[model samples]
Target: MRIKALALAATSALLLTACSDSPSDTDIQAALQPRLEGASCVTAAMFKSFPVTLGSTFSTGVSSGNAPAFDALTDAGLLAKSDKTYSLTDPGRAAYVEQASGFCYSQGYEIAKIKDISPNTGPMGAAVDKSWIVTVDIRQKPIAAWAKTPAIEKLARNPENLSDVPKTYHVTVGRVKGEQGLKLIDPRFSIMRGVSVSQGY
Candidate 1:
């Protein structure tokens, strides 16, 4: 996946500013491991509507639905659902690490760096700013191999097989006023795989 230009510049600036008392590389990596692993958490709305497993089925019209994704996310301490909205918790940051780890192991490579992008308010309260970011780099060859189309395609595909009827992925999982719950999300956006970035990007 491509990093945003402004984000890249800002990230560089932040790293430059933080360079004075940065953690040792080993400690940094250790600190970031869990976040990367839990990056695949899904919203409650996604869990309710999509076919997450071979035979799992969920009702579309109802507000309450149980999902394996949520269970996994909650167990991993990566996701939490209140009302209907689904958001990542502290443990979910390992998503980046999980991606990097998979790439390294599958392609025979090394890790170079890990970048963390946290959640925060942006300039003038305009856009949502990435609170923190950890970037991890690996051996060029391994990264390239892992980034190839086949690997990406495999990761991109949904883990569950839905009915022959096609379904879209959506991120809505909450009330209208705020991050309340699943009802907040509009119905039009209905893609099945909510973990696009975590799964492939």
Candidate 2:
């Protein structure tokens, strides 16, 4: 009788332990997909810093009283929420990388280093206007080849080779007049790079 009781207790404990463990991959996937597809970016101002949240939206200036459009992300498991210190999950990072890759290919450009981008100016009037000052190591060889080819230059120089996002983007060329080495400017990156501009969304 004593042995049977001990066995029963052990079985119950195992069941409870299994229940409390991290969600399965299928569960994580289900939670991540929709949020990634329709992710939105909230400004760091919405929170105290990079990953800190100020209690709730009432304390911050975030619109919609939520973390902008990516609100669904946390529940989806793509975004981890530990008492408001949100961080991207592994799946979330993969999604970001994929999006960045697509944007690079679309613009006839590539991102040699994601960290190289930063805001030339501070945050703008709205929460989303903040942009990064991108330093594009111009693929001169490919561009030069295209220039030599017939009719490519005209198509490349067309005004349509720009984006139409709401935020402002800037670029730091390798060298420009009135500066040395790399020169930063108050330019729009999405337009100059001919890619979709987004704060994060």
Candidate 2, pairs of clashing residues: 31-76, 118-133, 169-188, 169-189
Question: What local distance difference test score does each model get?
Answer: 0.33, 0.36
Would you give me the overall lDDT of model 1?
0.33
Pairing residues by index, what is the TM-score of model 1? 0.20
* Model 1 weakest lDDT span, ten residues long: 161-170
Clashes of 1: 48
> Which 10-residue window of candidate 2 scores lowest in summed lDDT?
138-147
Q: Which candidate number has the best lDDT?
A: 2
Give the residue spans of candidate 2 off by over 4 A: 1-48, 54-64, 72-78, 82-85, 91-201
Q: Which digits, one per residue and each the tens of the lDDT, describe model 1 over residues 125-183?
A: 22222122334443211222212323233433453311122222212122123332112
